[model samples]
Target: MRSCIWMGSEEKRMAPGQSGPKIRLAGFTKFEKKKSKPYSYSRTAKLLERFKNRMSERKDAFGPQVERLTVLHATVKKIADVERAKKHAVEQTEEVELVE
Candidate 1:
């Protein structure tokens, strides 16, 4: 079997059971390959430094908020403990009265 692929003004053929599509490089089209630009080490370094600075600033900004949340958590836990103690005491008194 054979398949046809249209590229620009030419029709390329592909054989049966082929692993990949056959591309013809013998024609000129509207699309042309351009040379890739060179990499810049200084630009990459500046970007990385900026990213690190932002991360540190975020940590500093959230530090106080995190500490306040921790303090609130401890306070809630202490209140829960007191409530549990009161509940236990009430249950114990009910049990003693039933025994008597």
Candidate 2:
């Protein structure tokens, strides 16, 4: 039996009368071309800009109604809070009078 040791500076050789490993020559391989879609940044930007403009226009049309509803909601909440505070104050006064 022989040791299959290899050295960096030496070329590849085979043992007595044995065939060596086959070498592959460099060659270009044939490849299929794939069809792909091209992307455009300017078209995407224009679409986004158009969408924003439409959204702003729609918001403007309903802006006054939206403001009125918001104000109405705030007024109702304020009234509820005032009523709650008055009830809490009365409860505290009754507790103090009973203690005295």
Candidate 3:
């Protein structure tokens, strides 16, 4: 039985036609520092102004309807509270009569 030892191949020699300009290998540390534009206060102010205008327009369109609904809700809640108190009073009177 013959035992064989494995050996790694030598570095590849470039072909004669491929020897002109060396190929550049891209690496993580080779990036250029990028220049960022400065923030503008005027642009931010304009955006905020437009947002506020749209919000005010929406509030103006729905303000009266919202107020009317709120008032109706409060009136309905008051009526329900009054009916519940009356029901409790009637139950108390019935219980007292039964006790007597």
The residue ranges of model 1 lying beyond 4 angstroms of the native Cα positions read: 1-61
Residue 85 error, candidate 2, Å: 0.8
TM-score of each: 0.39, 0.37, 0.39
Off by over 4 Å in 3: 1-61
* Number of clashes found in candidate 3: 0
- Screening candidate 1 with a backbone cut-off below 3 angstroms (N, C-alpha, C), the clashing residue pairs are none
RMSD of each: 21.7, 23.8, 24.6
Ranked by lDDT, the better of candidates 1 and 2 is 1
Whole-model lDDT for model 1 versus the true structure? 0.65
Q: In lDDT terms, which candidate is top? A: 1
Clash count in backbone of candidate 2: 0
Backbone clashes under 3 angstroms, per model: 0, 0, 0
lDDT of 1 by residue, 21-86 (tens): 655676754467798885343444445455545555777776765565555555655666676688
Q: CA shift at 82, candidate 2, in angstroms?
A: 1.0
Write down the lDDT that model 2 would get: 0.60
